[model samples]
Target chain A: MKKMLAGYDAVAEAVKACDPDVIPAYPITPQTDIVERISEMIADGELTSEYVRVDSEFNAASTAIGASAAGARIFTATCSQGLKLMSEPIFSASGMRLPLVLGIANRSLSAPLSIWGDHTDTFAERDGGMIQFYAEDVQEAMDNIALAYRVAEDKDILLPALSCLDGFILTHVQEKVDTFTQREMKEFLPERDPVHTLDPSNPTTMGAYARPEHWTETRYEVQRAVKRSKDKIGEAVEEFADVFGREYGLEHNGLLETYRTEDADVIIVALGSVCGTIRYVIDEYREKGEKVGLVKPRVYRPFPAEELNKVLGDAEAIAVMEKDVSLGYQGGLAIDLKSALYSNGSRIPVLNYIVGLAGRDVTKDVIKKVVEETKEMRGKDPSDIGLEEEERWEPLREELLPGDKDD
Target chain B: MKQIRIHGRGGQGSVTMASMLAKAAFETGKESQGFPSFGVERLGAPIEAFVRIDNKKITDRSQVYNPDIVIVQDSSLLKLVDVEKGLKEGGMIIVNSSEGPGDLDLETDAEIVTVNATDIAMKHLGRPIMNTALCGAFAKATGLVDRESMARVIKETFEGEIGEKNVKAMSEAYEVC
Candidate 1:
């Protein structure tokens, strides 16, 4: 039987089923419900986990790190500023290879302090050594949590994992999610075998500063473990599919899901929840006989280069939509996509359209306009088009009351 | 697919309501999805929850821009947010208000059903969390799930005497609504 639930509730239920020994989280906008629910479960005796209400996100990550180092399956959640605050511990968790799973409610980093959805927070930590997986919706968020744990705990890939979800849009939004029963999850992920634990019986010093003689090699070992996570994630995803009846296609490494791209002149590449809107627009345009499609990159990190190249090779033009931007540089996702295609030698006039930053709505009309504009620009000379320069970064218009003096 | 949107504040049980609604729908052999939208972490800020129930698989993951039913846990939201934004013509609006259906000056042509969920919640549960009460009224108004099934789901979700109190509150709200 299937039921609908809020994204946070779904995540909470998944976390409950996973039965992590410790959950240390500092509540933030959009992600507060998840921790709140988990805390409630612990109080009500529904969950036997140690619910740690930490002072800050830094503490939350540190607490999880401590629990994980103590050989217990641990979990934590944060968003936006919280994630930034927890960066030090995030790196420590990865450096120590603590095998912790953190739920990141992807939110916009504040300058003007917007507590909405965006990829900037996650993008900032791209090189943190933790395997990152972007979830498109609530169900994916729930599934990714369990998969993240499995992959992180794998002996070959004993690295931490971060599952990203759009803060308010995906985190707080309610949707139908296929929540696995505790029994089902147990079947999917077996009991953890404490390999390198901080047990008194086996005293092991974790995160010891190695001499320069072996520092480079230790770093190389960490890199190798992170690289191995690519396969570990794929294997865990496949195993999850076998048990849950939902396949993530994680094995298809450069796995970019193409929608209606067959015989398409223009294609839009996007990630996270915004891709769903793009898919809707593509479907509508396809109905109107306009050969347009969407190339949704499932794996954002370890950048899916070869797969995106093959999927986008046939298109005359491509539009990359990003929900977050890196000031002075191109949008993070757009830049990554551009680099992915660069080595492929496919100069498919890729236009970068940064839309829906900080939780602003990206309507189907906006997606349609992007596709139409991309198609029109494809007719111009490659040099004249200047795909990068063509991007128009307009400030978001603030809605003012009828007689507001601020306006 | 049948999409239902619930509007409430942060302290309200919009998330719990969506979960119970989904659980009830699931009990009736329907595929259902539920999620919530919260702006700030603070209590009493406007929060929204969504539920999608379908006979087949649910592919769409976007917010329910167009809903077949709009469950308003806070009547005050009717003045703040566009509560009736994408409600279908014949769609139902279930408001947990002390006001009667005729009392509301709703501009839309959709059916309006009102229940004083707060009163029932406070009277039965001894608190102001009207989510379970509103869920009962929602089931009563839409017939999306039978009252018995909703009560059963509520009982299973809650525990001890609180579960029985919520069930009674739901029954009272259903009858009154």
Candidate 2:
């Protein structure tokens, strides 16, 4: 039945259908609804799962690790600070080669303690050895949950996976979502026959300490497994498209989704929910007879280098918009895009435009401006064009009060 | 295609209102999408939710700029956010306040429809959360979704006692607004 489902509820329902044996979560804004729904589903007997309400995000991840290692399909969700707290176990989940799936609501890292939409929290774990797939909207968020499980459980690529969505941007959005029935989900996602499990029947040693003599090779083998996971991700997305009438290309569709960029001279590259805005802006510009397009990267972890280089081969200028800052460096997505193009020996001028952080709105007009700026920078010197500027930032509040307005 | 933006706070149910409106539109056999933009992660911080309804499926997923209708769940958001920034000329502005349409202290070229949804909600539901009541007012003003479809969705969403009170609140809001 067609139901109006909020993004978070859709995810929770998909998780329930997947029938994960263990669920460990810590409550965080934007992501709280997902965990709360899951917990309630378990409590109401709608879902029969080991609902582990952990004291902290770290414990949440640890619990998932232990459960997965003990041969159960495990699930967890976190955002911003919660993700940071779970960083150590995230790496452990990867290192131990546990086939775990995590629903990550991407939020800004704290200091100022902003619980808004941003890539800082996810980008911080870039080196955590987990494969990451970003969903553009609520539908993808639900689809990716199922796909992540399938890809992670592939024996040849037994590694953890993360399905990341813009914290409140996509998570809290209510949209028409088609939930899969158990029969449909079973057909879409292969049942788990874990490569390694804490089977008391088998009596195997797990996560045993490797001495320095053999530790280096063990680390190398883990690296090899991660590299192999890229291929598995592509295959899984392809299989999902075939089964569900949706194609998330691995080598081609998996890496990037280019919209109206074939004949366009200016292309804007972005990820996550902002890609949706860029697509809207591109349509508007196209209506005005401007050759503007958008290239959205779907896979952020393995860094879709080959696909991006090919898609951007003909573009005159590429504008990269990132929600997370790289501090002294270019924005995270910008840096990755630059590296991808650099390896191809392409001298295409790539401009970095950072917009929409802390839940700031990225409207179509802002995207149009970025395209206009990229066109204006066509003949200008790279040194003359400054990527970092205050004007690029979207204004959060129209009126700033000097005193308290609460009275 | 028509887009609508709802402005409120974190716990104020702007997202819920957006979803209900979309559901109402869907029940009428139209394609609709609703989403929210938020960050404060706290109770009272300002938040915004958007809805797009069309005869055809909406492929564009962007914030509703040049909205055909604007629904303000809180009047205070007017001073904080540019609520009328991209309002279409002659579009409708439905605010949940005690003030009349022209009573609002703002400049707008659109048709304004104001309802004291807070009073209606409190009178019926005994709470100040005006999302569902404002949604009823929005439906009455814009006619984007029929009141009957909205009531059905509301009944299905809320349970037992709360559902009865919210239905009363919505009916009162529709009558006055």
Candidate 3:
């Protein structure tokens, strides 16, 4: 059915359609409604699932781990501080290879504690071993939850997954979403086939202690599964396309999505919903005959290095745009992208433009300024605009186009 | 493309108003998006929500700085923040107050439309959730979405007797415009 819903409701409905057996919920702003709606569905007898209102995010995540290990389909959600609170269980859930899904309503990691949208919350957990799917809108949030289950439950890739959507930007925003019937949903996302279970009849010790010698191997196994999940994501989305008639990327389910990068002189790279804003800016620039394009990395976990090396290979410069910082390091996406480029032997200069932390608006003008700066460094060493050893900055927010509002 | 900015304090349903407006617009075959500004969630704090209606899908996720319409659910906020900031010249603003256009002495050429939405909401719904009432004002003020669409969305949103009461509040507010 075609209906309009906020990103939160869309995700809640998608989780409901997955027919999850258990949901461990903690009320966090922005993310609170996703659970709230699901609770309503359960209370209204529309969805039959255990909605456990946990005391803390830590318990919420631990509950997911417990439920998933018991061969039950599981779902959970958190944001910002809540995400940090659940970090311990997040890593354990993936290492144990539990096929559950966590919805990360993206928010700024707090020092002074802000509830606005930013990538720092999810970005901080990149190495935690959970498959990360960055959704740019409501449709993607709905479809990605299905895709998350399809990819994570693959026996070869039985790992936990997290889908990140910008906090209020997408989570609170209402947009049109085309829902699926139970039959269609079952066809798209089949019943979960657990690889191992915690039953007394066929007990399997999960997250068991690994000695020093086996520790490295255990870590490598999760890394390998994460890397391999890249292809599984593509395969799942391919089947999703056959059933749903909507394709997310070229040739793959969606490693990264490229826009007009084929012949552009400067390529812009970004993640999450900011890519939509970049598209609007690209359109304005292209209308004036500027050779600028955009590359959106939908899967930040696998890092999409090969796709990045190839899609931006022909461009004169690469502009890495993000809304977060790696603290002592510069932009998180910028650093990872630079590492990807260097490992892939790309010599193209990469400019880092960090914008919109604490929900500072990333307007068309801010993007235009970043593009102009990247355009200036066309043939310079990639090091010129690359990450420095000691630097932390907010380029578009503090530098260009300072907002009219006081921080 | 049509952009509208809604200004209201927390607990006033400004965000819901934006969502309802988007739903109504989408029901009328226009692609629409609605969202609220993020901060510490609180009651009585100033909050702004935006709605964009276009023939094509909207891509710009930035805040609506320049809008075709500005809606003020609380007229007192007009003196607090620049409720009319970046409104297009000769645009329109619908204020939720009993004081008609003459009492609203804003120094803009934009058209001013006033309805006592709070009074109407209390009169019809027995509560002062003026969002539905203001939706009626918005429907009549700009015709961005039809009165029928607004009624349908309000009914679909509230349901049963409460929905009928909201529909009445909306219609009564729309009538004065």
Compare candidates 1 and 3 on lDDT and give the better one. 3
TM of each candidate vs. truth: 0.82, 0.88, 0.94
TM-score of chain B of 1: 0.95
The Cα error of candidate 3 at residue B159, in Å, is: 1.7
- Residues B81-146, candidate 3: write the lDDT tens digits: 898899988789889987978788577788899999999999998888999999998998888798
After superposition on all CA atoms, what RMSD does each candidate show versus the true structure?
Answer: 4.6, 4.9, 3.3
lDDT of 3 by residue, A1-26 (tens): 88899999999999988899999999
Error of 3 at A141 (Å): 1.0
Question: Which segments of model 2 are wrong by more than 4 Å?
Answer: A250-253, A377-407, B7-15, B35-50, B56-66, B72-86, B95-108, B114-133, B161-165, B168-177
**Weakest 10 consecutive residues of candidate 3 chain B by summed lDDT:** B34-43
Q: Model 1, stretches more than 4 Å misplaced?
A: A1-3, A19-22, A40-54, A66-71, A181-207, A210-217, A254-256, A377-395, A398-407, B1-23, B35-37, B41-53, B56-87, B90-104, B111-143, B157-177
**Which is better, 1 or 2, measured by DockQ?**
2
Native-referenced Cα lDDT, model 1:
0.81
lDDT of 2 at A400: 68
Kindly report which residue pairs in candidate 3 clash with one another: none
Q: Best candidate, DockQ-wise?
A: 3
* Docking quality tier of model 3: high
The best candidate in terms of lDDT:
3
Error (Å) of candidate 3 at residue A358 is 2.1
- CAPRI docking class of candidate 2: acceptable
